[model samples]
Target: MTEITTAQPRSLTTALDIPRPPDLSWYVQARQPVGYEVNLTRGLLNPDNPALARSVGADGYTSVRTLVVVDKVVDGLYGKALRAYFDAWRVDARWKVMPGDEDTKNLEQAVEVTAAMTEMGILRRTEKVVVVGGGVLMDVVGLAASLYRRGAPYVRVPTTLVGQVDAGVGVKTGVNHGTHKNRLGTYFAPEITLIDPEFLRTVEPRHIANGLAEIIKMALIKDASLFRLLEETVAGIDGDALADCGPAMGEVVSRAIAGMLDELEPNLWEWVLERSVDYGHTFSPSLELRADPPLLHGEAVAVDMAVCVALAVGRGLLSQADAERALGLMVAARLPIAHPVFTPELLEVGLADAVKHRDGLQRLPLTNGIGDCVFVNDVTGDELRRALEFVHAYAGTRDGVRDGS
Candidate 1:
């Protein structure tokens, strides 16, 4: 027994291949139907109407409270009035005001918001959290709602045009982490998204143009009619014009909202890699986060879209005239079509990251014309460099005009 030497374990090549019933072959699947309304209304915060209470589910239960996380700017503008409105409806409410800007949107801010909601004792499935602000606050607080006790009901009252038309309409919520745009996030739909054009009245002019960038993206990728509408009305879209919500502006918002819904609703979880909606997003994230002044989300997207247009033109998938028209719309909207941060090296890094994100292939969506898209996996690093240079030269011409040179 002592000399057995543990049976010498086993010979190096003694065992033959023996396969058993392969661990019970199976797959798991589920379907969760998430439906939310993105309502575009005016005067949403008016105390005379009980719509806010109804929208937040405060009218459904007396014991429940609507935990309101408001952007600092929104709070300054309507905080007292909002509190009075909630009180008039005899609805219990708690308000927490936080700064809502790209720089402030982070994991700590999200955690802070979640902690405040936690202190309010909101019920997971019943009581609602109301996030009132621009895109940044919506993202930060929406992320909080998604994390608290696993998931909680929330309503979005988008106060900015960008919030109403783009960020608020989608289910994705996120905050930047370590120089990465939306590095940590989750896709959690809101119970309702209340969009009031009235809020745009107080927004700065530059912000209005920021919102138009996303709409332009939708038009270029999927809706020719939308592209035409934008071409028809781009000159009239001043900051004040958006606030007025005239017929033209209404159609723009409606069509953009509808287009976004059409693209996003079918694949809310973003299971598809060749997403038309990712046309500008592939390169914008890095440009947005790494810029010296930290360019606005849509500004970076506009620049990225310009580069993609150049890439498409180079491939002969899009005509030079069509590319100019697409880019001209961005210029007419007063959106920046290029930035110094969008150098060849930076763009290459963004494209490489996007390739990884798209599951090891470049699922780059290029325009076939102004309104159709084709996903290509064959974009080379040289093509990306040339595209960046093309956008830079084009933007120089546009900037010269703005500078009155």
Candidate 2:
């Protein structure tokens, strides 16, 4: 973990088990759905979608480097969006293909890729880079765009379920080290985000479940309606299920997008940054870091949320029943509460890494109840170890270990 400094939120705090609702009495959910004007249109391989070009015109972008994946099925669709958007727009546009996964986003990889693209004369100062893909593509391109000549405008066209609902749209950018996830990163906002749910048809169900975890986390933090929807609508998201078939799916997704709009408006620099919104994720990167090959980003976060909920129970912050019920829904939705094979040793390391990566929090805002949480930064190291051990054992991921001897 890089010895990063931790910043405390403007809030009250208490003992480990005492969760409290945020003081949002003065805050109201915005009227226009919490985001900027969105043109979520549908079209097939059209060369003049105009939405992209129109966004450029409105956002004042001059040069553009559109990057995407060639392997995914939706590549053709994105290619269509890009080709048409580029041809119709008067702004300078370049297309760069980025490699996938943690490796490509590494500092060296980002340095090399950006330089090569520049050598090819595809990037410039007058334009911003537009990234099109799932989370991995977004992070790599987001990081590159942030550093390219200091900074440039960028837009996101998230094509996967996880990308669409969670990681891609967020301006949190980073590359991972061997066992540490998102070890290097920055906070840069995208100029525009174009989310089209129709793209989910091409995504794998596991990946869809991965995205669902984050939505469920959002529900845990803010919306009970979303929690109920996940409980009723999610039966078997894996195998041969269209995960988004239920009305609950649409309801939750709409609410999330609305929340996104609230913070991402007029440039994403305000109070709604990813850290403030990503509750359980503060520990998730560490859990993934403990994995030999590391779990997928969403997968690790789902597991982390499970443990987080349980810890909330142990600390008197959340009810045991609530934790169980949430875990049950996650399991039914086919998300894992357990790692492939978790051990106390690995868990200790994960906890330390999680806390370290988060810069020795203030633990993530542990939920006292729906739309309620308390800031707790003074937990003993032993307590966190015990919490991790107990959850892992209960979920059959490890042997039962009490919360400290």
Candidate 3:
């Protein structure tokens, strides 16, 4: 008579390990710690600033070689200044200018940027790519830098209001693909990001409004004080006011940046699909790409946020008065609360796509109240239809002015 016993497996040593037979499987694990700075400065291209020059780890005595990928519009405005700054710092910079609009965010544009890097003989590790433009340009060049030699260092100098406050501060690089916004993208951190509010002076009023929408998203989902500040100062806030960097705008920028960083730092790779920062993003991607005139990124987001607010109210997660105030703030900021393109069919399609993107659940972020958020996975088609109808009626009360009017 023989008694048989099974052997116990040894304990796993790594986070990614499976407790399988060593002879049958192998496992390895590694963690990459990403650290980067988002610096707020004025006149970044001024030769005397030294902020941009120092970011590349350059001293005054030695000449550094680097590639600069800039948006054509930004280049037109600051090319000479950038040239003089580099020349003064004894740095050799190769300039690659490309169009930086929503329409131009694509794989081809990213390839063009990579080609420019190759032509300039970019050093994979030692030298860095400087991206100067709005969110679109940053995404394109960031993707290019990420693809070059598998991974190359890059710096972001976001020139638009959206760039300074939202896109420029984050580590996501993406381009729209075939009618899908940010369908193709990568999570690549920049070496550093320089934000200059002074750049906003030349931005159009409409674009300024576009940027404010993102700030509002932060307010609704994270900071009640920020929402109050926006309510108080939105009447006087414009591109010029933001460029001036006065007390109100400065606080707005500071809080928005801090709030965004707070939400992002904890979950940079988004291993957790539930996110408060995704409040307005759930449906905006589809609407942004489908609009006839092409709504700006923030404009699309505003419409989505409005609908989500209405959804929250219907669910009793937010007060009716709070919903009105939130929608009112969007109008005051000159952002769109409703659009013709955001139809019931589009809502269904967007939710379907979002479910796929969020790992087989809606995970839709809705404002529970001012400065708070909740995710709902069980949102039905009827609910979305009612929300859309509510948004349209709310927009009508504003003297028949809709988005793009």
Measured by lDDT, the strongest candidate is 3
Q: Which pairs in model 1 have colliding backbones?
A: none
**For model 2, what is the alpha-carbon lDDT of residue 236?**
45
lDDT, candidate 1, 1-405, per-residue tens = 467555566644446333346643557999888988888777777766666888766553464578899998889988988888888776788889999989998999999988887788778787889999999999999899899998998999998878988999999999988978888999999989988888888888888888999999999999999999999999888767887889898888899999989999888998887899998999999888877776778888888899999999999999988988988888998888877667788888998999888899989999989889999988888998889777777777785122211
Q: Candidate 2, overall lDDT?
A: 0.62
Q: What ranges in model 3 sit over 4 Å off?
A: 1-23, 399-405
Measured by TM-score, the strongest candidate is 3
lDDT of 2 by residue, 6-26 (tens): 876644444344456673344
Model 2, position 35, has a per-residue lDDT of: 37
Off by over 4 Å in 1: 1-28, 60-64, 400-405
* TM-score versus the correct structure, for each prediction: 0.90, 0.74, 0.93
Supply candidate 3's per-residue lDDT for 306: 93
Supply candidate 2's per-residue lDDT for 56.
50
Of candidate 2, the 10-residue stretch with the lowest lDDT total is: 396-405
C-alpha lDDT values of all predictions: 0.86, 0.62, 0.91
Order the candidate numbers by lDDT, best to worst.
3, 1, 2
RMSD of 1: 7.4
RMSD of each: 7.4, 14.8, 6.4
Residue range 1-405, candidate 3, lDDT tens digits = 899999887656544565556546747999999999999998888888999998886787899988988889988988999999999998888888889998999999999988988888888899989999999999999898889899999999998999998999989999989878888999999999999998999899988988999999999999999999999999999878998999999999999999999999999999999989998999999998988788899999999999999999999999989999999999999888888878998999999999999999999988878999888999999999999998888888873235444
Query: Of the pair 2 and 3, which is ahead by TM-score?
Result: 3
